[model samples]
Target: MEISKQYAERGYAVIKKLLNQDEIEKITIIVDLIYDRWLNENGDALIEHQLINMHSLTHPRYFKNNKSERIKFFELIAPEQLTDLIEKMFGKGINFHNTQLFFNPYTNTKTPYWHRDLQYSLIEDSIQAQEQNNILSLHIRIPLIAEKGIELVPGTHKRWDSELERNVRLELNGHINSEKLPGGILIELEPRDILIFNAQMIHRGNYGLNKVRKALDLCIGKQHHLLSGFLDRDILPNDDEIRCISNNQWYVLAKDIADQNFAKEIEN
Candidate 1:
């Protein structure tokens, strides 16, 4: 069972101990630095929104005067082992879109909910199901702290939602989004493990069990019409900065897309 095959069949794959102890320690320290800043700024808002995750980890606004820290974080994220794994998953033309940091909601009362990533977007359910196989959006999760945080429905990536799933996910009929679906598997990950899952699969972040959930997700994949225009120009590296990056393929692709999108925005 190769990784690709397993991924294609199960909609997710876990690479255990992908990062060594040293790498894990460095990431944890930097992640805590970033998380503390974000939490300090958005603690109240996280409770208000019932948000369990934060995206766009490279945004310049977060760093402000601490540009060196941002660059260091970027360098840590693009290590040779991770980059090589990403290449093996999706060879060329795959862009690193954005980064997301997953943590527990500010309040313990907020339970997790199930969803495909596109369901929150403007795209309709029918359209998303029809185009499911065409898109390749993925969440490469790097757990900075060990936890059983993620629950995913296996094989859902290859098919559309069943009626029960639709009802539970959409909260239609008498069902609620938090209601557990059949075949849902809770994923337990350690500090150094990496898990790759389809962004469009039926999944949720399990809350309350762990007081601290610090998982850094490298959102990467092919740019599609359904999932384009999200790359923020300020978050991506410029021409000079990218030169110093190790395994710069993903960042280069991301910068190109960001530049193009920025130009398009200006024109419009």
Candidate 2:
């Protein structure tokens, strides 16, 4: 309905009461299990695995690993109730881009700079493609606790940043205080609320200090989507979580997109 239009115009939409309390309880059980693992072990191995696999450019202090754990995490998320809404927003050819489980601690409350998801190398090409084709991709963020976290500048998705904004973002290097940033819109969400935003929009988080600020950032896109540099370019066919969520139609579309990107690499 109006949610899709609002998302296009403002680059984000907040769906209140999107998940009932019962659903939230079920999801929280899984989340707590993962968090408990991190707490008990301090997740040294998980962190080590991520450091080895991740591009050097990314330096996330906290994240969730364990494929089986992630499978359970996504299993709760990929139900038709959510995918159906996403498909309606962007039409067919949807593919899972990536999943991020953020656990920003109070000690490391400083957050990254305001930036668009498009890689710097791909920015110009992405802008051109968006103008020509209306390619809309987004991050569906589900906060497990009430938090005033995400901050963004509305309509930033449709326009490049101003000189001042760019300079500020560059100088701060993702360490600036989010609330102090000019023209920032702070989005406060409750436990069961859903906040979906175009990742292309300039945004950053305000780290929560009271408790472990936790959220799930799930990226989804149409076939021609360009995403952040951190994304794994290829989705392995044997990935159990992906296969569980995807049927034949979804698999074919995802495979075609992955193949096209791979072909481009070989050609270059």
Candidate 3:
């Protein structure tokens, strides 16, 4: 499939019905299993109540606190057709920075704040410097259900500046109106349809009274020194133990090692 020129110029693209029914079914099954396990393990906590009230579910410490077994599973599944498309955009030898499962579970929440993913990356001290790199962080959203979908503001990625992040967050919190914000195309995504975009794009999740909406969020970037160099100078192990496992497994193991090494420095 040809990459959309519109996406190249505007910094975002959507390819509809990219995955077949079988592939979608397979992925949905795996995702459902994971979500069910997570809920079963954490059902009675105050944190669960907070999640319900927030009308969203996210593991803030997901990358930092997960077991290697789950990570391995992700790594094994990383090199599928979707990753190939990302490799086309980001070039070969890319690294998986993180993956998240976003769920808007049956609520009337308006929409999430508009912001770029780069703000949260450890590479830059501020969003301004990160933007100067022109490094594109590829985001792939695979919807698990067809009810509620995300809306993307077209061409807004090119127009985004640091100030927009603040404005968008305030707008999401009911502090201001987003009328001035650019309008986006509403995507009715089918299962496994992938929407790829740069990190700076203006986008938000629209739950719209849907009972449950889930999506797998994957972030991938090139491994060149210009981009990867900022992550930290530490060398990742390449031994059999590390290479033998899947990419997801490697992430989990890496997090465990980091936690053990930095335990005392972290405050409760």
Best candidate, lDDT: 1
RMSD of model 2 against the true structure: 5.9
- Residue lDDT tens for model 1, 106-141: 778888999999898789999999999999999989
Backbone clash pairs for candidate 1 read none
- Write down the TM-score for model 1: 0.95
Q: Candidate 3's residue-wise lDDT over 125-208, tens digit each?
A: 345444534666566777778745666777756664435445564454454533345565566766757777776666666666
Candidate 3 positional error at 4, Å: 4.8
Per-residue lDDT of candidate 2, residues 196-224 (tens digit): 99877788776643265677776777645
- After superposition, which runs of candidate 2 have C-alpha atoms over 4 Å from their true positions? 35-72, 106-112, 119-135, 172-179, 208-210, 225-252, 259-268
Q: Which ten residues in a row have the lowest lDDT in candidate 3?
A: 52-61
Winner on TM-score between 1 and 3 is 1
Candidate closest to the true structure, highest TM-score: 1
TM-score per candidate: 0.95, 0.71, 0.66
